[model samples]
Target chain A: MRHPYADLVAHAAHLLAAAGLDGDKPTVVAERLVRADAMGHTTHGLALLPAYLRDIGSGAMTRSGEPAIVVDRPAAVVWDGRRLPGVWLTARAVDLAVARARDYGTCTVVIRRSHHIAALAAYLTAATDAGMMVVVASSDPAAAHVAPYGGKRALFTPDPVAIGIPTEGDPILIDISASITTAGLAARLTTAGRPLPGVWALDGEGRPTDAADVLSTDPRGSLLPIGGIDHGHKGYGLALWIEALTQGLSGWGRADGEAGWGGAVFVQVFDPELFAGGPAFRRQTEWLAENCRANPPIDPEKPVRLPGSKAAAGVARAQAEGLELFPGILEALVPWAERLGVAALDGRA
Target chain B: MRHPYADLVAHAAHLLAAAGLDGDKPTVVAERLVRADAMGHTTHGLALLPAYLRDIGSGAMTRSGEPAIVVDRPAAVVWDGRRLPGVWLTARAVDLAVARARDYGTCTVVIRRSHHIAALAAYLTAATDAGMMVVVASSDPAAAHVAPYGGKRALFTPDPVAIGIPTEGDPILIDISASITTAGLAARLTTAGRPLPGVWALDGEGRPTDAADVLSTDPRGSLLPIGGIDHGHKGYGLALWIEALTQGLSGWGRADGEAGWGGAVFVQVFDPELFAGGPAFRRQTEWLAENCRANPPIDPEKPVRLPGSKAAAGVARAQAEGLELFPGILEALVPWAERLGVAALDGRA
Candidate 1:
């Protein structure tokens, strides 16, 4: 059954509020978490609510006041999240960055000690709508689930880089992890007795293995970098840089040797009006969108889909006809809703 | 026999000079070209001199004076390269960006109508060494060699992105293209009758194929984005944003529809000191470098390598011993050197 997006947000906020999130933080959390699902990234969407609640319950990530402004320059900022939920901390950071971008044509904001900010595409999409392009990169020093390109051991987090650009038709939000597929996907494939698309993971012996061979016992396989073997070096390079920007710039430790909890992030916001006139920038963006859409198609059934097109469509559909939760996602949230005494999801959850 | 790097630069400079390029521009071109080879990017190095000479000779990419500063903001700049060699234009742009970065914490310089900047690693390496971080991305609005992800025809450049980070030890430089394999490599694989690694390319029918089956006729297959088939969405997204920044921001056209012969470039330089203290930034970079090096290798023979480690080794070795050109590089250059009346490479070629 489909539920209005607003109901999901209110329910999520209610649960978060009952779980000790005070002030407007619960709304921030609910909104971003719901948008993840609305934007078609169900992996980072409400499915992660259990983990967030666990983190909150265990005091692993605590709600906090405004982000601590460690370093504040006209064009740069370092926001210590004070161990806050990433959704709340990043929401504050984005506003600061957008404000700074207005003053300086560009702004670089580094965040530390924040939990997973959820889907970066959803986070950066706002900047796109604000007529700015943003590049957001994050690394969880705590979660080292991806192996380096050729090396087998998991020494890196599946670092993600997201870029959001404003277009007339739809804002382009390209958010992708450095890994070809996620560790979770690899696990699913292992259980399903299916091979991954390619050499997208390595077994415990540090040898390449088909996904079907990733047994539950002995050594578990690690996710491969984007491009897998052929050009994994590119993804590996992207991962390294993402780490440098997020971890290095934020002064958070690397994910390799010792990783604590929380995340290190780097956000770069740029005002197109600074370089090209806003109108020209908009017009050129339209030109690019047109040319990309006009690209010759290999499959008659599928045109060259620009980044965020599908997600945008999903969001538009949800806004008009209501959003549908994954088959079991709503049901899975029933317990949390019951435990928190929040009103149960009306759509059979 | 192999000549020293300086001689190679000098010979290259002489050739460019012979091709009507005078003043410091030729030397700038020569140095960057030679450095590309020294850094182990032979494809973009002197091996590309033939193409460069042809472009200059054809007047498609002309040698010009310093880039014209069309829009200059404290933290942003729009440079009209006036169809100059990318090396010179970018060299000047980097300096201006560096200068502006010093004043504004961060600076983004956009360039229009520039030739190939060769390897961005070398260009941004200077910034890294100077205690700043820089992200460089370029798209050739005129030449589209890569198909959009899932699309058959070429609609995008093999758009390249590079990031450089400063550290106390070896700096980090990550330079990568958006394609899994280059068109040139695909062609070579086709000619050699060797199957390409994984499903790295497409066949003439726009279907995925191994390298050996690339029948390069009517519908010559285009190179896939970095993630190939499974996750090419990531690479496509990267290509789009890179285009928005380089082509869109610079007000240059996209690579599709109309063809041109130059680059639209975006270079963002940020001082790490603005966020983390310079000393802390340096220490953290060193920490990251050490952690990356210490990462357990999947193979005993190959350790995890940071982005620039291999290139650094190559540069160090080339400095210790004379730089050696690739097997056919010197031979290939001999004709151009001979045509320009420059002393031919003293090597066997």
Candidate 2:
């Protein structure tokens, strides 16, 4: 079944408000979560609402409060999210950074203790639409599912980073995790008794394996970093850098003890008008995008495309037609909708 | 044979000065190149001197000139390097960024038309020693050796990125290329009739192969991105981000056509005192480093170590004893030394 995008966002917002989110938090969180689905990141979309609701019910997530300012400067700012909705906090942070970047030419905001920010890609368009470039990264110090380059024990999370570049047409959005595969996909594959397509995980004995179940074994396996076995040192270095950008800069992380299911985020915005003129920046970016698209592809049937091209197409399709929610996503939300006394979404094309 | 570090620097500086560089340019370039050797980055170290000398002889590199200031703002600055020595340009840029960052919280400097900067890691310690975090990335618009994720033809360079994070002990220095291996290593292996240890290249037909000779074939195979075949999109995205940071921000790139053995560079520095207090920042970073080092290794005999630990040790060893020049490096420089009428270095411990 297909549901209108606006209707789905409204329904989600209503449920979040009834569940405990106050002021504009419900709307911001709902919009960003749905935006992830619109961008084809189903795993990070409405699927996470259940866990967020659980956190709220258990008082793990705080409601009705603004993030406390830890440090503020002309080009750098640090915020203590206080377990607030990460979607709302990140959205607010991007706005603040974009505004400050105009004056300072660049601005960075680091947030600690933010609840899991839904897909990093979901927050990129806000900055790109304003004709600016932005970088976003996140790490969860409380979670450990990835190991160092040659270590057998898990010591880090996926540690994802995203960059948004403005061009003449659609913005180029780059989002990637330092790990080869994400823990969410690993868990889902394990539940279905399926093996990964590639050797993306290492067993407890540090041997490469294709079985997702290795992650659930007695001694426990770990996800391989982006470079996998032969060159994982590169990925390991990248993960550590992301950790420093997020947790180290924020002054709170694994060293300070776990703070439940939350994240530490790094957001920086750059204004091209301040560096090289906007026209010059666009000229170079657009030219590169064109050349990349023209490059001959390995498979002739699948032409070369820019990083964010597909996501842009997905957003257009979802808006024109209707959003096709992933299987089980809408069904899982029904119970929450009923419990919160919110009207259920109509599944009509 | 080993040579005293000071003697090697002086010899290299004399050669550079005789070739064409003026004032402190020769000394800055010589020190940075030798520093790469001390850190075990032999490929980027003194081995590059022969080619640099040839560039000077051919008038490809500017003899003496000041970089034109394209734009100057509080937090962002751009420079037209005018084909100056990249080592000197990058070192000067880092120093300028560090100074500005002290007042602005953060500062970014982008340079276009710089000759190849020696090694990214060589420029990191300058910021780390000052208790600041720094990021450096570079791309060569005139050359392409690594292919895009799904494409068969090369559209980008190795696109190396480096980060320096200060801790209580040695700073965590991360230096990595977006590609699995660099073109210089590929060429050297091919000349020696050796195959790559892994399938790190794609032939003209986009078939994965370990033969370094494929890179020299008629159709020309290209180096694979860091993630290799199944997961190269991540690396491809990172490479594009680097291009944006270096060339796009500087308003110059591949779009301007080949400019002959030059690079576009990006350097940014951040002060911990302006973001989170310096003590709090160091506390988190130090704790994370210790925990990482303590991670159990896959091979019990080889324990886990941070990214720059080996480099730090290499520097200590070289300083204590003497520098070991890679085989043929000194021999290759002999011709340039005689042509420039500079004194040859003595190989004495």
**Which candidate number would show the highest DockQ if scored against the true structure?**
2
- Per prediction, fnat is 0.68, 0.79
lDDT of 1: 0.78
Which RMSD values do the candidates have, in order?
2.7, 1.1
Return the clash pairs for model 2, or none.
Answer: none
Candidate 2 C-alpha lDDT tens digits along B1-349:
7777888889899999999999899999998888899898898999999999889888898889899999999889999999899999999999999999899889999999898887999999999999999999999999888888899999899999999999998999999989999888888789889999899999878899998876678798899999999899989999999999998889998888966999999999999888887787888889879888888889889898898888888888877787898888899998888888887777566
Clashing pairs in 1: B142-B260, B196-B211
TM-score of each: 0.93, 0.99
Lowest summed lDDT across 10 adjacent residues in model 1 chain B is found at B252-261
Compared to the true structure, candidate 1 yields what TM-score?
0.93
Chain A vs. native, model 2, TM-score: 0.98
Over 4 Å off, model 1 = A184-198, A210-220, A255-260, B184-198, B212-216, B255-259, B345-349
Indicate the DockQ of the complex predicted as candidate 1. Answer: 0.62
DockQ-based CAPRI category assigned to the predicted complex of candidate 2 = high
Q: List candidate 2 segments past 4 Å from native.
A: none
Q: Comparing to the true complex, what docking class would candidate 1 get?
A: medium
